[model samples]
Target: MANDTGKTTIDLGNLKAGGFIKERGKDLFTVRLRVPGGRMTVPRLKKIADVAEKFGGEFVHLSVRQSIELININFKDFDAVVAELGEGEQKVASCGARVRVPTACGGCEYNPNGLVDTQRSALEVDEKLFGTPTGHHKFKVGFAGCPFDCPKSATNDVGFQGAIWPELNKDECISCGLCAKSCAEGAITLGADGKPEFHPDACIYCGDCVKVCPTEAWKAAKKGYTVRIGGKWGRHPLVGTLFATFLPEDRVVDFITEVLAWYKEKADGAGRIRIGDIIIKEGTESLLDRLRAGFPDFVVAETIPPQAIATQVGK
Candidate 1:
């Protein structure tokens, strides 16, 4: 749309939906690209650099969510910019009330602390759920390969942290006390009889005991994600509460879908309420009851309330 001055009147909502963030300058936008799990190929990155120099500012902005945003792009060059990005197979990210791109840590692929393929899960989520409208507010998801939680999973609306439940086989045990020494949480202690006694309550499920056991006595009885729900980081930062334990990797998508359904239904008419706020208003038990119908085995009967943190300015 053009105005009397012959300047293009852009639809800000439409542009934002297509990842064209309006800049302070007239007719300028920032093109945000989807980089799932923060993984990118060298050639593609080079192409992005070329595109940014040609159609936008000389430098690209790396968003905190791991997206590459081409800054200071003229609205008139939108088509050209998208066309150039397409050649590199780069798609624009979405904004508004939708599922944003997923962030992840380097998972079991190379990180020694990793216990799950978080990168793969992140890519899968981006493929299946990225940009799906949340109906109320923006929803974010993050994946951490293990309890180290390098990705800060608890700050997202839905988070997944890799976990392992270990089991000890007494028959194969060498009783060297290696597992006890390896337990950083002090969940394991050498028993009076020189055997290892595990305190499940203190275990963070990092799998260090299983990894350090020389006799292969400590084995992973279960390996999956510890799910956290209703987390959000903003002015009123709310740390997500544990919702489920050892959720199967294959069932992650289904689990998210169910949670979204509950959020959508519960958050209706609330006017831009986040999932965490809805949980606060409706109570965790309400969502848990709905989730239990589909994920009875994984849903927890009790969970700690989401923590509300005080945000300080100019501190």
Candidate 2:
């Protein structure tokens, strides 16, 4: 192909296998379709697959963010293709800047944490931060079912994980150390007079020890989650810093919504960088400052883990 000046066109045909990506509009730019939490009902998938076969390639590509990227779109036909997606009540937005996909647990069977249903919270987060903004770079968040880390929460721009408060029954403990055996992290141990000793630091907050206790000694702890931020898992993975544990389960959506708004205000255009990058350039203090600005009243600090080792012994 030649331009008006008769210059040869730059062909990226080699980059694609099936063939050069098809072009729809006057010019070429990649189009990213957001799918919150990597979820799509069967009907939703069917419609998108049809688009892929018609406008794009035969199938859409899955993304790490749980989003779908449909390439080779022409601006002219983009609207029609999107409309055909047929995701009832499904909303559309730019997947850049403040605009990005929201993520959540894809339904975990053993979620001991406070989080019950994540779909609603995921929607709220998207509504709050799904567009381009002056502040920091692209931010990413992960929602987890439990401490097992299905989506790798600790490495996101913001992370929310389920937690349980403890309910101890002194009368039932037989000093058998069954809880000690149950604790994979050795967070529990037998105390004097058949009671149990708790060492929160030793506890990873996993609740394994509590679950295995025969007498129902350790019931589900008060429900809640830990909010972590400024982390990334890439070439240089950074473990996010914990902002708070035990945020009321119901208010988490609002809390995160506020956090995104605050993040935007803090960076202005400069903050529009990734969480890991921001942490390096301005330091956690600056990020925290922006977070604090959003909610001056809320205190965000890491909560201590559980105390006591598992009961590996018997009465």
Candidate 3:
């Protein structure tokens, strides 16, 4: 129903229950539980299975936001289910105009290609931003361990990708060429002198060269987060624009808070409003100016579209 400002209000009880309103069921609801970073301990897993078997219809559905949903829970069993989940210390995930559970790929924890601790970042974001109010629409955040963007961070409201800029030491180079071979972006190539040459503009800073360098010729010059803002996926998907890079992990929380504050300040509506729209309407440079003003340490990426062709040479 609409509230005082004509904004639609979601039910507080349903939100707390992580309840999904069912259209065709004996009970009106199904519950969703948050599992940040999409990873859970064995004990918690077992507890969830047992709880589902006891109260739900013994079926669990996994959500895109890294949450687990127990279906076929009757209204009468709601209290019991909530108590069981509480006892297990599992938080319920809500779906509305708030920060949802963050999603992340397996970062440096185990993935060979990982450049940063994505799981740890996810947990940190969850602790700091989960369920925080957004002014007009829902906000989603995702973290990718590297440029692979496995978690589809490109399509989230706030996307953080792990990166490392590598520096080469010509003296230490054995010139094995492994770094060139490992680089998928063609950012690194062995020159005639048998030393690796780097193309900074083409490099996504995935850190492959650093990992593959046998002589430690390619060293990590800068390791940090690349921020992408104003992206979302749905009927009309808009890929987020790259906002900043080389953002130290320690400063990510502050960056996110400022971005959210800016969004809330600019967005005004009862219906869904996205940061991408704000960027488009006000010009990306406007947002960039504010970001630069607030966080002077960050290096914002310059986005320039390809120049137009003079003529269609081939049809």
Candidate 4:
């Protein structure tokens, strides 16, 4: 039924899904623009500024998920705003219970600490999976170039952090101890024989040793992403647990597809349950079993419980 304003409830819901968020004002909305991987050209950014000045408020809101929200837009100007944005090849971001735009940090292209091409990965995921229906709730994905985790990968539903497992070639070792000196995790230490001793348990896989080894003695044994599943931040935050190590970059999309399949099946008939909650209810082993069928090599055999933060306020 149409409200007194002559718009049905469905109209507002559809607008929300299309990135036109209703504001407290009677007819004002916020128009969110899709900027995948948080990267945009100067010309495109200039276009957004022009659009904001013409159709929106004095300021635009930069969303935490790396989208740009043009504020104080009138519902009547939605079409005009979208058209103007399209002139610059920009598009609207999605909201509601769907896969939102992927967020990422500067990857190996520019960032010195980056171990993988996170920007490329984020763009790929955005192109293939952005705005997919999650059925139960919103799904988030993040890509961190390295363990520095500028994008806070562990706070998303599906998170990927670049990793590198290093190996020492004793034949090339100059015994200069640079590898041990560069290891922040202390995973590498010089033994009595002046050779580097590796403690795998202590390694966070940042590749510092490999980079610092002047003689190329330390090298990457494996380089890929460390996948974490079912993480989220909200009223009740859960830090995602490690699901796979050294997951090949080429297989990320397929891996996510399988994860979504499992989520859809398990979350069926369960109202508004996040992936982490399903894991908590059905147990991590259940999901592991499903993943192992397709990804026996990358999937870890064991996983730790997602850390739950106590967020009860005034209880």
Candidate 3 lDDT by residue in tens digits, 1-315: 455898555435635523354636765466788888999888888888888998887579898778889888766666667677764477777677788788999888789988988898888888888888786788888889999889988788888999999999999999889999999999998899988899998999999899988899899989888888878876557778788888888887788888888888778653578777777776777778778877777747465211122244474
TM-scores for every candidate against the unseen true structure: 0.93, 0.73, 0.88, 0.93
TM-score between model 2 and native: 0.73
Top-down lDDT ranking: 1, 4, 3, 2
* Model 3 segments more than 4 A misplaced: 1-23, 304-315
lDDT-wise, the better of 1 and 3 is 1
- What stretches of model 1 exceed 4 Å from their correct place? 1-16, 312-315
What's the residue-level lDDT of 135 in candidate 1? 91
Tens-digit lDDT track of model 4 for 1-315: 345998643334435556888899988899888888899999999999999999998899999888899999988777677777883488888988888899999899988899999999998998899888989998889999889899999988899999999998899999999888988888999999999999999999899898888999999999999999989998899999999989988888888989999999999999898899999888999989898998999999899767787888669
Question: Superposing all C-alpha atoms, what RMSD in Å does each candidate have to the true structure?
Answer: 2.8, 9.5, 6.4, 3.3
Residue 212 lDDT (model 2): 73
lDDT of each: 0.90, 0.61, 0.80, 0.89
Clashing pairs in 3: none
- Cα deviation of 293, candidate 2, in Å: 8.3
Which of candidates 2 and 3 is the stronger one according to lDDT?
Answer: 3
Q: Give the 10-residue window scoring lowest on summed lDDT in candidate 4.
A: 8-17
Model 1, span 209-252: residue lDDT tens: 99889899999999999999989988889999999999989999
Residue runs of model 4 more than 4 Å from their true location after superposition: 1-17, 313-315
Between candidates 3 and 4, the TM-score winner: 4
